[model samples]
Target chain A: AQTVTQSQPEMSVQEAETVTLSCTYDTSENNYYLFWYKQPPSRQMILVIRQEAYKQQNATENRFSVNFQKAAKSFSLKISDSQLGDTAMYFCAFMSGTSYGKLTFGQGTILTVHP
Target chain B: EPEVTQTPSHQVTQMGQEVILRCVPISNHLYFYWYRQILGQKVEFLVSFYNNEISEKSEIFDDQFSVERPDGSNFTLKIRSTKLEDSAMYFCASSADRGRATEAFFGQGTRLTVV
Candidate 1:
Protein backbone atom coordinates (compact mmCIF):
# COMPACT_ATOMS: atom_id res chain seq x y z
CA ALA A 1 0.00 0.00 0.00
CA GLN A 2 1.23 3.44 -0.91
CA THR A 3 0.41 6.45 1.25
CA VAL A 4 0.97 10.09 0.35
CA THR A 5 1.19 12.81 2.96
CA GLN A 6 0.94 16.58 2.69
CA SER A 7 1.79 17.99 6.10
CA GLN A 8 0.74 21.50 5.25
CA PRO A 9 -2.95 22.03 5.57
CA GLU A 10 -2.92 25.56 4.17
CA MET A 11 -0.52 27.86 2.32
CA SER A 12 -0.63 31.36 0.91
CA VAL A 13 1.46 33.31 -1.57
CA GLN A 14 1.36 36.86 -2.82
CA GLU A 15 0.63 37.57 -6.44
CA ALA A 16 3.76 37.51 -8.61
CA GLU A 17 5.62 35.61 -5.89
CA THR A 18 6.54 31.98 -5.44
CA VAL A 19 5.30 29.19 -3.18
CA THR A 20 6.38 25.64 -2.57
CA LEU A 21 3.97 22.92 -1.37
CA SER A 22 5.46 19.98 0.50
CA CYS A 23 4.66 16.33 -0.16
CA THR A 24 6.04 12.94 0.89
CA TYR A 25 5.03 9.34 0.33
CA ASP A 26 5.70 5.85 1.71
CA THR A 27 6.04 3.22 -0.94
CA SER A 28 7.99 0.04 -1.38
CA GLU A 29 8.03 0.07 -5.14
CA ASN A 30 11.08 1.51 -6.86
CA ASN A 31 9.32 2.48 -10.06
CA TYR A 32 6.44 4.91 -9.79
CA TYR A 33 5.16 8.34 -10.73
CA LEU A 34 4.37 11.52 -8.81
CA PHE A 35 2.00 14.35 -9.63
CA TRP A 36 0.58 17.59 -8.33
CA TYR A 37 -3.01 18.55 -9.08
CA LYS A 38 -4.86 21.82 -8.54
CA GLN A 39 -8.56 22.22 -7.89
CA PRO A 40 -9.96 25.72 -8.05
CA PRO A 41 -13.34 27.03 -6.89
CA SER A 42 -14.85 25.63 -10.07
CA ARG A 43 -14.17 22.13 -8.71
CA GLN A 44 -12.20 20.86 -11.68
CA MET A 45 -9.04 18.88 -11.07
CA ILE A 46 -6.30 20.33 -13.23
CA LEU A 47 -2.86 18.90 -13.79
CA VAL A 48 -0.11 21.03 -12.32
CA ILE A 49 3.11 19.05 -12.67
CA ARG A 50 4.28 15.46 -12.96
CA GLN A 51 7.58 13.64 -12.42
CA GLU A 52 8.65 10.16 -13.34
CA ALA A 53 10.53 8.33 -10.59
CA TYR A 54 13.34 7.23 -12.86
CA LYS A 55 13.95 10.70 -14.18
CA GLN A 56 16.24 12.61 -11.90
CA GLN A 57 15.41 15.82 -13.70
CA ASN A 58 12.40 17.52 -12.23
CA ALA A 59 9.47 18.41 -14.48
CA THR A 60 8.48 21.98 -15.16
CA GLU A 61 5.39 23.34 -16.88
CA ASN A 62 5.65 27.07 -17.51
CA ARG A 63 5.26 28.40 -13.96
CA PHE A 64 4.85 25.06 -12.19
CA SER A 65 7.88 22.87 -11.31
CA VAL A 66 8.62 19.98 -9.02
CA ASN A 67 11.55 18.87 -6.80
CA PHE A 68 11.47 15.09 -6.73
CA GLN A 69 13.79 13.31 -4.28
CA LYS A 70 13.56 9.63 -4.93
CA ALA A 71 15.57 8.26 -2.00
CA ALA A 72 13.94 10.65 0.43
CA LYS A 73 10.54 10.03 -1.17
CA SER A 74 9.79 13.74 -1.30
CA PHE A 75 8.07 15.40 -4.23
CA SER A 76 7.26 19.07 -3.74
CA LEU A 77 5.63 21.52 -6.14
CA LYS A 78 6.82 25.07 -6.68
CA ILE A 79 4.71 27.74 -8.30
CA SER A 80 6.54 30.77 -9.64
CA ASP A 81 4.98 34.09 -10.54
CA SER A 82 1.85 32.97 -8.82
CA GLN A 83 -1.37 34.50 -10.00
CA LEU A 84 -4.81 34.86 -8.47
CA GLY A 85 -5.95 31.96 -10.58
CA ASP A 86 -3.42 29.74 -8.78
CA THR A 87 -5.47 30.03 -5.61
CA ALA A 88 -6.84 26.54 -5.15
CA MET A 89 -6.48 23.21 -3.34
CA TYR A 90 -3.30 21.36 -4.27
CA PHE A 91 -2.91 17.61 -3.98
CA CYS A 92 0.07 15.26 -4.18
CA ALA A 93 -0.50 11.91 -5.82
CA PHE A 94 1.43 8.66 -6.26
CA MET A 95 1.02 5.86 -8.81
CA SER A 96 2.89 2.60 -9.12
CA GLY A 97 4.17 1.83 -12.58
CA THR A 98 3.55 -1.88 -12.15
CA SER A 99 -0.14 -1.61 -11.32
CA TYR A 100 -3.11 -0.06 -13.06
CA GLY A 101 -3.38 3.70 -13.17
CA LYS A 102 -4.65 3.91 -9.60
CA LEU A 103 -3.55 7.18 -8.05
CA THR A 104 -3.20 7.54 -4.30
CA PHE A 105 -3.54 11.14 -3.23
CA GLY A 106 -2.54 13.02 -0.13
CA GLN A 107 -4.74 15.18 2.03
CA GLY A 108 -4.83 18.37 -0.01
CA THR A 109 -3.22 21.70 0.86
CA ILE A 110 -5.44 24.76 0.47
CA LEU A 111 -3.40 27.48 -1.25
CA THR A 112 -4.45 31.10 -1.55
CA VAL A 113 -2.77 33.68 -3.74
CA HIS A 114 -3.35 37.20 -2.52
CA PRO A 115 -2.69 40.51 -4.09
CA GLU B 1 -7.92 18.36 -27.51
CA PRO B 2 -9.89 15.42 -26.20
CA GLU B 3 -11.12 15.45 -22.59
CA VAL B 4 -12.88 13.20 -20.13
CA THR B 5 -16.40 14.37 -19.36
CA GLN B 6 -18.77 13.54 -16.53
CA THR B 7 -22.51 14.26 -16.48
CA PRO B 8 -24.77 15.62 -13.74
CA SER B 9 -22.38 18.11 -12.21
CA HIS B 10 -24.30 17.75 -8.97
CA GLN B 11 -26.84 15.25 -7.75
CA VAL B 12 -28.85 14.97 -4.54
CA THR B 13 -30.31 11.64 -3.53
CA GLN B 14 -31.87 9.99 -0.49
CA MET B 15 -30.11 7.35 1.53
CA GLY B 16 -30.63 3.71 0.44
CA GLN B 17 -31.26 4.88 -3.11
CA GLU B 18 -29.11 3.90 -6.02
CA VAL B 19 -27.12 6.54 -7.86
CA ILE B 20 -25.34 6.09 -11.14
CA LEU B 21 -22.57 8.49 -12.15
CA ARG B 22 -21.79 8.58 -15.85
CA CYS B 23 -18.57 9.46 -17.57
CA VAL B 24 -17.27 9.48 -21.12
CA PRO B 25 -13.56 9.07 -21.36
CA ILE B 26 -11.30 10.13 -24.17
CA SER B 27 -12.08 8.10 -27.27
CA ASN B 28 -8.52 6.83 -27.66
CA HIS B 29 -7.84 6.11 -24.02
CA LEU B 30 -7.88 2.59 -22.66
CA TYR B 31 -7.59 2.96 -18.89
CA PHE B 32 -10.41 4.34 -16.70
CA TYR B 33 -10.43 5.27 -13.03
CA TRP B 34 -12.77 6.52 -10.33
CA TYR B 35 -11.78 8.68 -7.37
CA ARG B 36 -13.61 10.57 -4.65
CA GLN B 37 -12.89 13.38 -2.24
CA ILE B 38 -14.92 13.89 0.91
CA LEU B 39 -15.82 17.57 1.41
CA GLY B 40 -12.41 18.92 0.40
CA GLN B 41 -10.42 16.18 2.02
CA LYS B 42 -7.99 13.72 0.44
CA VAL B 43 -8.86 12.19 -2.90
CA GLU B 44 -9.23 8.42 -2.50
CA PHE B 45 -8.93 5.91 -5.33
CA LEU B 46 -12.03 3.82 -5.84
CA VAL B 47 -11.46 1.55 -8.82
CA SER B 48 -9.50 1.14 -12.06
CA PHE B 49 -10.89 -0.50 -15.18
CA TYR B 50 -9.24 -1.82 -18.32
CA ASN B 51 -10.17 -4.18 -21.14
CA ASN B 52 -13.75 -4.32 -19.84
CA GLU B 53 -12.70 -5.59 -16.42
CA ILE B 54 -11.56 -4.21 -13.09
CA SER B 55 -7.80 -4.26 -12.61
CA GLU B 56 -7.59 -2.89 -9.10
CA LYS B 57 -9.73 -1.27 -6.41
CA SER B 58 -9.11 0.32 -3.07
CA GLU B 59 -10.41 -0.90 0.25
CA ILE B 60 -12.82 2.01 0.32
CA PHE B 61 -14.60 0.42 -2.61
CA ASP B 62 -16.97 -2.04 -1.03
CA ASP B 63 -19.47 -4.59 -2.24
CA GLN B 64 -22.10 -1.90 -2.68
CA PHE B 65 -19.96 -0.19 -5.27
CA SER B 66 -19.70 -1.47 -8.85
CA VAL B 67 -18.36 -0.16 -12.15
CA GLU B 68 -19.34 -1.04 -15.71
CA ARG B 69 -18.81 0.06 -19.27
CA PRO B 70 -22.18 -0.53 -20.83
CA ASP B 71 -21.22 0.87 -24.21
CA GLY B 72 -18.14 1.80 -26.16
CA SER B 73 -18.07 5.30 -24.74
CA ASN B 74 -20.00 5.35 -21.48
CA PHE B 75 -18.42 4.31 -18.18
CA THR B 76 -20.55 4.27 -15.06
CA LEU B 77 -20.21 3.83 -11.31
CA LYS B 78 -23.14 2.47 -9.36
CA ILE B 79 -23.67 2.71 -5.65
CA ARG B 80 -26.46 0.37 -4.60
CA SER B 81 -27.22 1.89 -1.18
CA THR B 82 -25.73 5.23 -0.39
CA LYS B 83 -24.80 6.31 3.11
CA LEU B 84 -24.34 9.77 4.54
CA GLU B 85 -20.60 9.23 4.41
CA ASP B 86 -20.88 8.69 0.68
CA SER B 87 -21.34 12.40 0.11
CA ALA B 88 -18.37 13.64 -1.86
CA MET B 89 -17.09 14.84 -5.21
CA TYR B 90 -16.59 11.93 -7.58
CA PHE B 91 -13.99 12.23 -10.33
CA CYS B 92 -13.59 10.25 -13.52
CA ALA B 93 -10.20 9.90 -15.14
CA SER B 94 -8.51 8.16 -18.09
CA SER B 95 -5.02 7.42 -19.30
CA ALA B 96 -3.64 6.20 -22.60
CA ASP B 97 -2.19 3.03 -21.15
CA ARG B 98 -0.90 1.31 -18.03
CA GLY B 99 2.65 0.82 -16.59
CA ARG B 100 4.27 3.83 -18.21
CA ALA B 101 3.05 6.30 -15.61
CA THR B 102 1.29 8.22 -18.34
CA GLU B 103 -0.68 11.22 -17.26
CA ALA B 104 -4.37 10.74 -16.56
CA PHE B 105 -6.83 13.43 -17.49
CA PHE B 106 -9.61 14.08 -14.98
CA GLY B 107 -13.11 15.28 -15.62
CA GLN B 108 -14.91 18.00 -13.75
CA GLY B 109 -16.09 16.14 -10.70
CA THR B 110 -19.73 15.40 -9.87
CA ARG B 111 -20.76 16.42 -6.39
CA LEU B 112 -22.93 13.74 -4.82
CA THR B 113 -25.00 14.75 -1.83
CA VAL B 114 -26.62 11.92 0.11
CA VAL B 115 -29.31 12.96 2.51
Candidate 2:
Protein backbone atom coordinates (compact mmCIF):
# COMPACT_ATOMS: atom_id res chain seq x y z
CA ALA A 1 0.00 0.00 0.00
CA GLN A 2 1.19 3.51 -0.83
CA THR A 3 0.78 6.31 1.67
CA VAL A 4 1.33 10.03 1.09
CA THR A 5 2.19 12.30 3.99
CA GLN A 6 1.95 16.06 4.25
CA SER A 7 3.77 16.97 7.49
CA GLN A 8 2.59 20.56 7.66
CA PRO A 9 -0.91 20.86 8.96
CA GLU A 10 -1.12 24.58 8.20
CA MET A 11 0.89 27.12 6.25
CA SER A 12 0.66 30.83 5.48
CA VAL A 13 2.29 32.96 2.84
CA GLN A 14 2.19 36.68 2.13
CA GLU A 15 0.71 37.85 -1.11
CA ALA A 16 3.14 37.94 -4.02
CA GLU A 17 5.53 35.71 -2.12
CA THR A 18 6.31 32.06 -2.57
CA VAL A 19 5.19 29.02 -0.60
CA THR A 20 6.28 25.43 -0.55
CA LEU A 21 4.24 22.55 0.78
CA SER A 22 6.14 19.42 1.66
CA CYS A 23 5.06 15.89 0.78
CA THR A 24 6.56 12.44 1.14
CA TYR A 25 5.33 9.02 0.19
CA ASP A 26 6.12 5.36 0.76
CA THR A 27 5.93 3.10 -2.24
CA SER A 28 8.02 0.23 -3.50
CA GLU A 29 6.97 0.61 -7.10
CA ASN A 30 9.55 2.07 -9.45
CA ASN A 31 7.02 3.66 -11.76
CA TYR A 32 4.49 6.11 -10.37
CA TYR A 33 3.17 9.66 -10.54
CA LEU A 34 2.86 12.41 -7.98
CA PHE A 35 0.42 15.30 -7.93
CA TRP A 36 -0.67 18.30 -5.95
CA TYR A 37 -4.35 19.17 -5.80
CA LYS A 38 -6.05 22.28 -4.43
CA GLN A 39 -9.43 22.20 -2.77
CA PRO A 40 -11.01 25.60 -2.31
CA PRO A 41 -13.94 26.53 -0.12
CA SER A 42 -16.18 25.63 -3.02
CA ARG A 43 -15.09 22.03 -2.42
CA GLN A 44 -13.84 21.70 -5.96
CA MET A 45 -10.57 19.78 -6.28
CA ILE A 46 -8.31 21.24 -8.94
CA LEU A 47 -5.07 19.89 -10.28
CA VAL A 48 -2.10 22.09 -9.51
CA ILE A 49 0.86 20.18 -10.87
CA ARG A 50 2.06 16.66 -11.56
CA GLN A 51 5.43 14.89 -11.74
CA GLU A 52 6.37 11.58 -13.22
CA ALA A 53 8.66 9.50 -11.04
CA TYR A 54 10.86 8.52 -13.98
CA LYS A 55 11.52 12.09 -15.02
CA GLN A 56 14.63 13.60 -13.49
CA GLN A 57 13.57 17.12 -14.36
CA ASN A 58 10.94 18.71 -12.22
CA ALA A 59 7.59 19.69 -13.69
CA THR A 60 6.57 23.35 -13.91
CA GLU A 61 3.16 24.76 -14.78
CA ASN A 62 3.13 28.54 -14.87
CA ARG A 63 3.43 29.55 -11.21
CA PHE A 64 3.12 26.02 -9.87
CA SER A 65 6.05 23.62 -9.87
CA VAL A 66 7.10 20.42 -8.17
CA ASN A 67 10.40 19.44 -6.58
CA PHE A 68 10.40 15.73 -7.14
CA GLN A 69 13.14 13.67 -5.49
CA LYS A 70 12.45 10.10 -6.39
CA ALA A 71 15.29 8.68 -4.33
CA ALA A 72 14.06 10.45 -1.22
CA LYS A 73 10.44 9.66 -1.96
CA SER A 74 9.65 13.35 -1.71
CA PHE A 75 7.48 15.48 -3.97
CA SER A 76 6.88 19.05 -2.86
CA LEU A 77 4.75 21.72 -4.48
CA LYS A 78 5.97 25.29 -4.90
CA ILE A 79 3.70 28.21 -5.66
CA SER A 80 5.40 31.39 -6.83
CA ASP A 81 3.94 34.89 -6.89
CA SER A 82 1.27 33.54 -4.66
CA GLN A 83 -2.08 35.26 -4.68
CA LEU A 84 -5.11 35.23 -2.39
CA GLY A 85 -6.72 32.75 -4.72
CA ASP A 86 -4.03 30.22 -3.79
CA THR A 87 -5.46 29.87 -0.31
CA ALA A 88 -6.93 26.43 0.06
CA MET A 89 -6.34 22.92 1.37
CA TYR A 90 -3.53 21.35 -0.61
CA PHE A 91 -3.29 17.57 -0.93
CA CYS A 92 -0.48 15.41 -2.23
CA ALA A 93 -1.41 12.31 -4.16
CA PHE A 94 0.29 9.21 -5.52
CA MET A 95 -0.76 6.93 -8.36
CA SER A 96 1.19 3.92 -9.43
CA GLY A 97 1.70 3.44 -13.15
CA THR A 98 0.20 -0.03 -13.00
CA SER A 99 -2.58 0.59 -10.48
CA TYR A 100 -5.03 1.61 -13.19
CA GLY A 101 -5.09 5.30 -12.13
CA LYS A 102 -6.27 4.90 -8.57
CA LEU A 103 -4.98 7.77 -6.41
CA THR A 104 -3.91 7.73 -2.79
CA PHE A 105 -3.99 11.16 -1.18
CA GLY A 106 -2.38 12.74 1.86
CA GLN A 107 -4.20 14.23 4.81
CA GLY A 108 -3.72 17.73 3.33
CA THR A 109 -2.31 21.07 4.46
CA ILE A 110 -4.39 24.19 4.98
CA LEU A 111 -2.68 27.06 3.16
CA THR A 112 -3.54 30.70 3.64
CA VAL A 113 -2.30 33.48 1.39
CA HIS A 114 -2.41 36.70 3.38
CA PRO A 115 -2.55 40.06 1.68
CA GLU B 1 -12.19 21.51 -21.63
CA PRO B 2 -14.35 18.56 -20.77
CA GLU B 3 -15.41 18.31 -17.13
CA VAL B 4 -17.23 15.83 -14.90
CA THR B 5 -20.60 16.88 -13.49
CA GLN B 6 -22.23 15.62 -10.28
CA THR B 7 -25.81 16.15 -9.26
CA PRO B 8 -27.29 17.19 -5.91
CA SER B 9 -24.37 19.29 -4.79
CA HIS B 10 -25.53 18.74 -1.25
CA GLN B 11 -27.61 15.94 0.27
CA VAL B 12 -28.98 15.54 3.77
CA THR B 13 -30.39 12.24 4.92
CA GLN B 14 -31.26 10.43 8.13
CA MET B 15 -29.11 7.59 9.36
CA GLY B 16 -30.07 4.17 8.00
CA GLN B 17 -31.63 5.75 4.93
CA GLU B 18 -30.43 5.00 1.42
CA VAL B 19 -28.60 7.68 -0.58
CA ILE B 20 -27.55 7.75 -4.18
CA LEU B 21 -24.94 10.09 -5.61
CA ARG B 22 -24.86 10.64 -9.34
CA CYS B 23 -22.11 11.78 -11.69
CA VAL B 24 -21.62 12.33 -15.41
CA PRO B 25 -18.09 11.85 -16.57
CA ILE B 26 -16.34 13.21 -19.61
CA SER B 27 -17.64 11.94 -22.93
CA ASN B 28 -14.44 10.27 -24.06
CA HIS B 29 -13.22 9.01 -20.73
CA LEU B 30 -13.05 5.25 -20.17
CA TYR B 31 -12.41 5.03 -16.44
CA PHE B 32 -14.66 6.21 -13.58
CA TYR B 33 -13.96 6.44 -9.86
CA TRP B 34 -15.58 7.44 -6.59
CA TYR B 35 -13.75 8.94 -3.60
CA ARG B 36 -14.81 10.48 -0.34
CA GLN B 37 -13.24 12.91 2.09
CA ILE B 38 -14.40 13.38 5.63
CA LEU B 39 -14.48 17.00 6.83
CA GLY B 40 -10.93 16.85 8.22
CA GLN B 41 -9.50 13.70 6.73
CA LYS B 42 -7.69 12.63 3.60
CA VAL B 43 -9.48 11.85 0.36
CA GLU B 44 -10.04 8.09 0.42
CA PHE B 45 -10.64 5.93 -2.60
CA LEU B 46 -13.93 4.09 -2.68
CA VAL B 47 -14.12 2.28 -5.99
CA SER B 48 -13.04 2.31 -9.61
CA PHE B 49 -15.20 1.16 -12.46
CA TYR B 50 -14.22 0.09 -15.98
CA ASN B 51 -16.09 -1.73 -18.69
CA ASN B 52 -19.25 -1.43 -16.63
CA GLU B 53 -17.73 -3.49 -13.81
CA ILE B 54 -15.70 -2.75 -10.73
CA SER B 55 -12.00 -3.05 -11.37
CA GLU B 56 -10.78 -1.96 -7.95
CA LYS B 57 -12.17 -1.10 -4.56
CA SER B 58 -10.88 -0.07 -1.14
CA GLU B 59 -11.65 -1.36 2.30
CA ILE B 60 -13.90 1.58 2.90
CA PHE B 61 -16.19 0.34 0.15
CA ASP B 62 -18.12 -2.24 2.10
CA ASP B 63 -21.27 -4.15 1.33
CA GLN B 64 -23.33 -1.04 1.94
CA PHE B 65 -21.64 0.73 -0.93
CA SER B 66 -22.42 -0.10 -4.53
CA VAL B 67 -21.69 1.50 -7.91
CA GLU B 68 -23.53 1.23 -11.19
CA ARG B 69 -23.35 2.64 -14.68
CA PRO B 70 -27.02 2.22 -15.34
CA ASP B 71 -26.98 4.12 -18.61
CA GLY B 72 -24.70 5.52 -21.22
CA SER B 73 -23.96 8.74 -19.34
CA ASN B 74 -24.66 8.34 -15.68
CA PHE B 75 -22.45 6.75 -12.98
CA THR B 76 -24.02 6.31 -9.60
CA LEU B 77 -22.84 5.42 -6.05
CA LYS B 78 -25.42 4.11 -3.71
CA ILE B 79 -25.14 3.70 0.04
CA ARG B 80 -27.72 1.16 1.07
CA SER B 81 -27.82 2.20 4.72
CA THR B 82 -26.04 5.40 5.54
CA LYS B 83 -24.32 5.99 8.84
CA LEU B 84 -23.08 9.16 10.49
CA GLU B 85 -19.53 8.31 9.51
CA ASP B 86 -20.64 8.22 5.90
CA SER B 87 -21.17 11.97 5.92
CA ALA B 88 -18.50 13.44 3.74
CA MET B 89 -17.75 15.07 0.40
CA TYR B 90 -18.04 12.53 -2.40
CA PHE B 91 -16.03 13.16 -5.55
CA CYS B 92 -16.46 11.63 -8.99
CA ALA B 93 -13.51 11.45 -11.35
CA SER B 94 -12.78 10.09 -14.80
CA SER B 95 -9.66 9.44 -16.83
CA ALA B 96 -9.33 9.01 -20.56
CA ASP B 97 -7.50 5.72 -20.18
CA ARG B 98 -5.49 3.49 -17.89
CA GLY B 99 -2.26 4.62 -19.49
CA ARG B 100 0.75 5.75 -17.47
CA ALA B 101 0.29 9.49 -18.06
CA THR B 102 -3.40 10.26 -18.26
CA GLU B 103 -4.77 12.73 -15.77
CA ALA B 104 -8.05 12.23 -13.96
CA PHE B 105 -10.46 15.12 -14.03
CA PHE B 106 -12.59 15.55 -10.93
CA GLY B 107 -16.00 17.08 -10.48
CA GLN B 108 -17.12 19.51 -7.83
CA GLY B 109 -17.91 17.16 -4.94
CA THR B 110 -21.32 16.34 -3.55
CA ARG B 111 -21.53 16.90 0.18
CA LEU B 112 -23.45 14.13 1.95
CA THR B 113 -24.71 14.70 5.43
CA VAL B 114 -26.14 11.80 7.42
CA VAL B 115 -27.78 12.83 10.62
The residue-by-residue lDDT of candidate 2 on B28-112, one tens digit each, is 8999999999998889999999999999999999999999999879999999999999999999999998657678889998999
Best by TM-score: 2
Q: For model 2, how does the per-residue alpha-carbon lDDT over A2-67 read when each residue is reduced to its tens digit?
A: 999999999999999999999999999999989899989776688888888889999999999989
TM-score of each: 0.95, 0.96
| Residue-level lDDT tens digits of model 1 in B30-86 | 999999989857888999999999999989999999999999899999999999999
Best by DockQ: 1
Ten-residue segment with the worst summed lDDT in candidate 2 chain B? B96-105
Let me know the TM-score candidate 2 reaches against the reference structure.
Answer: 0.96
Each prediction's Cα RMSD?
1.3, 1.2
Candidate 1, residue A9: CA error in Å? 1.5
